[model samples]
Target: MKSKSIGLSPKSFYYGYDSKKDLKHLVRLVLILVFIALLTGMIGIWVVYRSAHERHLDMLRAFANTQGDVLDAYMLLDEVKSGRVHGDTPHEHNLDNVKELLLKQESFLETGQLLLAYEDTSTGKYILIGTGHMPSGQHSVLVVENTRELTPSMRLALEGKEGVLEGQDLHGAPVVTAYLPISKHNAGLVVMLNQSEFYAPYHRARLITLGIGVVFVVFGTWVIWSAEQKNLRQVREREQLIRLSFENSAIGKALVAPDGSWLRANKSLVNILGYTEDELLRMDFQSITYPEDLEADLDHVQAMLKGEINVYHMDKRYFHKSGDIIWSHLSVSLVRDEQGEPKFFISQIQDITERKRVEFENQRLHERLMDQLSLRRQQLDTASGALEGFAYSVSHDLRAPLRAMSGFSQALQEEYGDKLDDTASDYIRRIHRASTNMAELIDSILRLSRTSFGELNVVSLDITAMSKRVVENCRVVEPDYPVEVRVAPGLKGQGDLRLIGSVLDNLIGNAWKYTHGVENPLIEVGQEHVTLSEQSDDSVLAFYVRDNGVGFDMAYSNKLFRPFQRIHSDREFEGSGVGLASAQTIINRHGGQIWAQGQTGKGATFYFTLNHTQFDSEKNSTS
Candidate 1:
């Protein structure tokens, strides 16, 4: 029997083998494509997430810096007004008002909180002196009484480091905090916002990116498995989307080749340079860079390529297509391949021409202001010198004639007492008295002039000792008057010794002279610790001279320090009315203040402070 169907077609056998091999190859291709898609999606997600996080952090930092600047301005204003003549006790009251105003002004920021805090040197704990927003359920407006344990941010601020911190707030909510020191006051201002609120936009972006990435991965897998030609088309579409995203960005963006040529540039970049995209792509970055800035940019690029730095940012000038100079803030980062080799550079740029212009205008205005101030100062100096010369002339020329008139009148009275009639003798006596009074007035004017122009020599002074010397001198002058003086021991001050001594003599002598006939006459000199608006600590010394003397009406208190203005007649109080005026001039020259408080026949008190304790040499120099 013939073998049953032993013969086979060669074409059929070959077709079966070819089908198996093609199926195997297709399976391998699909697996490889899926793996690549998954990896690419994960990397894209990570990159997007990291970028979003960094951007959020940058925004928070900027906000914090702005808040710090505002707080610093308030502090500076407070310092300027600290030693002003407000006529209030314990200058801290004025500071409280300023703090309240700051809080009211800043409370409009609903999303964040602003606070002024100080660390108690004795307790080493932080105290919140002012707050824009009270914590939940807290009703007290003054938070200074409530001290809290120090936070890391507070510690850093007190240590003079301005920075940002992420941690829980007093209410135990996660927050981002920025703090800076109040340099003049030994305090800190903290700005804080809820972390969740700050990151809300990033969260939304992350979710959107995740969904889009998932869709693209699924669609990509299907396209790859269905047809190779379709896969290529899908890839082209993805690249187009990426390009669209790059071009539509709000900030200028560009891709630069390793050779410094711009491989691709977005519309924003083209607009910034006033050039077309095609034109920019053909030009290298060095060609458009300002000559002064090109060298630094090259150095930065070289550093990035050498892996010495990952990114660099600078403010640079670039030449526009029209050859005009344009200022821009540039940020660049190097992109690397999988093998960690430099591939290209990604650059982001922002136009800062308007900011630069504003800064230049401000500088010009400042220079003009300084020049005007200098000219005004010169004018004042000229006027002051002329006045001083006139005063000197009056003191010298007028005093001699007055003295001669008085001496001749006295001689006439002594020699011709028997020959002259009673009326003539009375007239001579009047002439003598008038000339003496005029002499006293001229002397008072001279003292006033000196106080205004005298140079000061600042030094530590034992005020108690100085007061004792003044009291002793007053006793020698009025040995008949019965007076009891009390001076506090260890009373110290910082000021010009000679001027302060003169101040004490006038104040104490006035006190002694005013209490003419009262029983148990007393004068007390002492210092009290007071707070100033500019300083956090209560270290200022307010010296006062208290006396149970013949005090005047409060209504005329404003005229007490005016030259030649007296509340009492010469008959009641023998004075030229220049003592207080001279004292005021001296105190003002020292950057101090003087004020009087009294009532009719009850008593009088004079308070003054040597402001050198509160103000530095620079401020005192101007004053």
Candidate 2:
């Protein structure tokens, strides 16, 4: 005969046809659990209720203190109206007014007394008007709601000695009390309270706890019994089942020697090492585990033994019966004895070789895809370089001959005017002007196309000095205006220098042109650090060329950066409408962006950002 334990818990195991023992054990376990839970819950309930009542008592105390001050005013009135009225002093006019005020606040005094605990020793009326003379050379105060209960210690208080005493009042209450003696002007006050009120909540709490404890035991037993029946549902009652439950339970069900030898394992665990059930029972977990995984598993098992982590899952390779490596997801837990120290290891294993293979394939594919993407980007940059070469040739070579043709045609008209009629002369002048304009248009397009290229020589360039040079060129173009220029220092930026310089030329030149209408114009070139969004992680310097000049309408700001887009006519401000487009292309080439803001009659400011990585690269390249 074999004996084993069984309850609702997996921690329990049934042995050798003892259904009666199994059911009994289950009932006992649930009862114990329910009892513990009831104990904790009842204690919590008691604390919460006690805290609530304590707060109520505090509110009571605060109300009493507030009321005492109100009653004190009435006492002051009494002192004034009845001031030493022993055939000596008359009631003053101020005293009469105070007496009236006291009558006015009588209702408030009545409501106040309702919250306080008191007994008047003078007349045995707890709320009657009583007297206490202020020891500060003032008349005696009329006291209300004063305690009158005199214990053995306090009854003697009127007889002239002062001491703390505990005794029953006229109401037969066992109370704690205090007495203050007043020999002068024949007056005294007694303070008392029944001690039972403070302990009432605690006594009620204990009673509730006892009731819950009994109920818990009964309910817990029923739950545990039901749970046991549910567990037995899949267990077919047969001789083999009775044997197999003890022999082949899934969690490495085993009985082992003190030396850690295996005594048993289930069919599920037998497959873990590609061995038969009989073959595995002779081998411990350490015998099959690879040397590399053995130490880690043992350390984890030690931690489980010390109750650090209750259960641990590990992926480890083990030598099977045929010396083949088999990967398993091993879960080790303790099989405890009656005294609860670990007696044997119950190691659960799940073969996961297929899953590992899939993961390795996915990781390799990801690396391949990343390499392909990088190669594709390099190819695209190379292609964009070839396009830039074609554009530069088209702009420089094609436009040079066009400019010469425009100059010769204009010279032919001026030098050979007598050889032509009015219609022919006008036609030649128009042809020359058209050719010059086309040359300017081609120049603008080439500038825009070159900036659009992907190949960029990014570096930190002094934008302050760059702006000053652009202003100097603007001055050479328009020396009559005598325009002012202000460039910010510490205004270095990260970008392709040639492209960024083109952007400054367009922006600062636009500012200078717009301000030409002003008799004395002011142009400001400045940069300030800023964040585009209030909560954005990106931070950058906001560089702007602002001018005190004629500005465009607010509505047309969106068209400013668009290619071949213009807000003003060529006649008003002679431009190809491609300057802003060229500027945007340059900024975009350096991984930055440009935008303009202006109001009707207010100056325009252009702002943009470069990446922090670009700034660091610029610093390194310069050094």
Candidate 3:
């Protein structure tokens, strides 16, 4: 038997369909939806109305209680003024005040009023003592009806049953009112709000809900009918979209037969291979694939046929129609028939020639940079060794000569004193001092160099204790100097213990040395709060050593940390000038900073910061 394509023609597909039955079903569904929508809207409207009404009643209850309290207050005041409790006749002035207060409150509401009434025992009727709508200066009058004819709210209040309810007011207008009895004053208070004003919002909500329900019904019904008619067209459009996507794709796409022959190719594939679709269909993938990549491609194909894999992806090279090799990222998937027989392959290819070229160039550049870095590291090692040798020479070889010179000068001065004049003795003393200074200078240079070169041994340090120890050492060296030193407690930091101690020695010792001659000398060691940046909440702790001493000039403060630089004369204060410089280097090695602030004879402060420690400013009470 010959095989036949089982497909429906457009004319038969359209003409043989029963749309009327489907339309009837859709109409029924839309009607059910509209009914549900309307029912929901009605329930929503009712909910809003009840909620608004209850809220109004709550407000009315509050107002009635407040008015009752005010009336009781006035009655109590009147009783006190009359020299009795619950006087039979209340003060008339107090009544007038109550009426004025009620009138003022009435102005705040729209269609709202307050009524104060007391029952006449003999007539069994209520007498209005005050009303918000009354004339300003009018006296009490019989404005309300008898107890039987009074409004429900007022009757309830007279009976001492306090509550809020909807009823008619004295003017026969519908209203919501709160009623409370002031038993002490033998009167009742009624606060009324017009029903129309209170319910306006609820009515607007109902109307809006109804309008929305109607619009929803009409729009929903139209949408259901239109969607039903467009279903067939959408299916057709989806097929067209798939076709257009395959043709307009930037990457190459092809369908190949199980025999490795091209069954179909898209325009992008034709462009990539520099061939027409008809020309590609006559060839096989193996003919265009580079020889180096052909074996791998064939392996993947064979494995796919044997059910080892459903898809394979790889970067491979292919020979274009122009005989140029191109790098491509290729993805292939097998499509099988329902009976598990191999049908064809779907291949997607992306050209990656430029990407491969850039990757190759970067690989070469990386290798070159690595070589240069190795050479530079070797050179730096050689220089560092040379520097170490030079420091050894300065510390040992040069220092020995200075010591000899100083010893010879002292011996000459002591042994030849009788033969020498005053000028010669002065010359010998100067030579001894110079030799001592030079030796000290050399030591300071070595200390400064070591600060920058050593590996940091960071550990938790009690900076407060260190500062105190430095201060105690100063007192031991100069026992007569009576200076007050205060080190703040809880000053903790993280840094190399020996290096940080050295920094403290320089800073605190300098403070002690400079405060020698000043009366009532004082030194303070504390941490200051320093924020890293305005935009960041992170902060660093900076410890400061402050002193009351002969401070240096602010203009020359920049020279304080330079090697051998001095802002003061040697006769006034002695220093090698490398202490602050060494302190700065140690701080920098630990990722911190150091600076000084001073004036011309008032005081000076040296501040230094350390990494990885945050201080609480509240604990800092030193200065």
Q: Evaluate residue 187 in candidate 2 and report its C-alpha lDDT on the 0 to 100 scale.
A: 27
404-454: candidate 2 lDDT, tens digit per residue = 888888888889988999999988889888888888888777777767765
Q: Which candidate is the best by TM-score?
A: 1
Q: Could you tell which candidate, 1 or 2, scores higher by TM-score?
A: 1
Which of candidates 2 and 3 is the stronger one according to lDDT? 3
Query: What's the best-to-worst order under TM-score?
Result: 1, 3, 2
* Candidate 2 collision pairs: 119-146, 119-147, 119-148, 121-148, 130-143, 133-140
lDDT of 3 by residue, 1-623 (tens): 10012122312221334456666887888888888888887787778778877877888898778778877786677667767665554534455556656645543377767777766555556667545444433333454457765678877887788998888866678888899977655667888778887677777876787788788889988897688669745654665577678778898998776667776778888888888888887788889999999999999999998999989999899899999998899999987766887767889988888898888789878878888888887777777667767787899999998888899888888899889999999999999989998998898888887887757999999999999899889888888788999999999888999999999999999999898888899999998766657998655567899999998888988898887888877888888889888898898888778888889789998888885333433324322
Model 1 alpha-carbon miss at residue 313, Å: 2.8
> Model-by-model lDDT, in order?
0.76, 0.63, 0.78
Instruction: Rank by lDDT, highest first.
Output: 3, 1, 2
Scored by Cα lDDT, where does model 1 land?
0.76
* True lDDT of residue 556, candidate 2: 90
